[model samples]
Target: MRFLIDFFPILLFVAAYKLQDIYTATAVLMAATVLQTGIIYGIDRKLQTMQKVTLVLVLVFGVLTLVLQDERFIKWKPTVLYASMGIVLGAALWGWKKNFLQILLGSQLTLPTAVWGRLTVIWVGYFLFMAAINGYVAAYYSTEDWVNFKLWGYIFPVVFIIGQGLYIARYIKDDSNGAEKS
Candidate 1:
């Protein structure tokens, strides 16, 4: 399930941290991530380029965590992941294609291009904020704080996304109403 897919990494991160040996934990995390990716790909019968790229990045960073013996590399993983998704989503708004969020939900939802653009910008800004916050926390806070933030910091983006959806629902008419026409 999508819920599990998102939560699994965080759970692994906690496990890795608790295990206390960066190299061994990194290997375990990397293996788990690969398996996760493979399962998703098998179920879908095709791998999204983004998913493949993400797996690669995670592996690379996980290895870096072991090699460098500093948790900073792993700590910044979400920041890079979110920033990349945000940029890609924002760029998709420039063309006719809606980004990942829309692709997943658009069948059951409706919103105009302007609304989508606004949503994308909001996401982009949030990602930037997350990246900055992650850097600050990892640099200044203890490892425990960094881990807690990784789990709890998801709140900000979820709230922002819900707010965006509510705003779109208020302003944008349903798809059947032809409100999405540019």
Candidate 2:
């Protein structure tokens, strides 16, 4: 259920692209994202920072794409988003000596400080890698190819998330028996 909600917009965007064109797909994506955000807010009673940022970016870029009739705006949206996240995370970790990831998830996961730092670094690297790859594809590929890549490129995030979960699993303390699980 959560997975479906998270991917609702992207799935709709791909379907719309297949059925129509990039502009139509952009519009569909914008609407689907707005709906997705609303659904998330309804379920959680609030919106996360990332969710808000994603909604704003989708609407802004989608509008630009439609108004200008240029696919580049929509295509580059992911790059911009990924790059911004990477930069913010990296800066928060190194410059400010703060780990945003830990700040956000520390209440839920009781990992060591060192583990949190490492996780933040890993996230920063992942975000930068995604941004670079998306930028490359969006700049060098045709719109159709970019759309196809968008559909298939989901594998990256899936793999990253699985890997992250596995990495963090060892550090997650088990409270069932009041003993460390790992």
Candidate 3:
């Protein structure tokens, strides 16, 4: 259910693209993202920082894509988002000596300090990799190819999330017995 809500925008965008064109797809993406955000806010009662950022970026870039009649803006949106996330996480972890991921999720999951630091570093690297790959594809590929890549790129996140879950599983404490469980 949650996954559907989260993915419907991209799914709609792809459908719109296949039915019409990039401009139509951009419009659909904008509307779907707005709807998605509202649904999430209604359910969660508040928006995460990333959710807000994503909404704003989608709207801003969607409008630019429409107004300027340039699909590049929409295509590059993911790259910008991924790069910004990587920079923020990297800067917070290295320069400020603070782990933003830990600060955000610490209340929900208790992990050793070192684990948090390592997790943040891993996230930073992942974000950077995503950013670079998206940028490369968007710049060098045709619009159709870029759109296909967008549809297929779900594999990267799926794999990363599964790997992350496995990595953290051993450290998660089992509340039933107050013992760590893998």
Best by lDDT: 3
lDDT of 2 by residue, 1-182 (tens): 98899887888899999999898999999999999999999999999889999999999999999999989999999999999999999999999998999898888899999999999999999999999999999999998899889989999999999999999999987688676554
Model 1 has an lDDT value of 0.75
Residue pair clashes in candidate 1: none
- Encode model 3's per-residue lDDT on 92-166: one tens digit a residue: 999999899999999999999999998998999999999999999999999989888998998999899999999
- Candidate 1 vs candidate 3: the lDDT winner is 3
Stretches > 4 Å off in candidate 2: 179-182
Provide backbone clash counts, one per model: 0, 0, 0
Which ten-residue region of model 3 has the weakest summed lDDT?
173-182
TM-score of 2: 0.96
Model 3 ranges off by over 4 Å: 179-182
Ranking by TM-score: 3, 2, 1
lDDT assessment of candidate 2:
0.92
- True-vs-predicted CA distance for residue 49, candidate 1, Å: 4.4
Model 1, total clashes? 0
Off by over 4 Å in 1: 87-110, 170-182
> What TM value does model 3 have?
0.97
Model 2 Cα RMSD, 1 decimal: 2.1
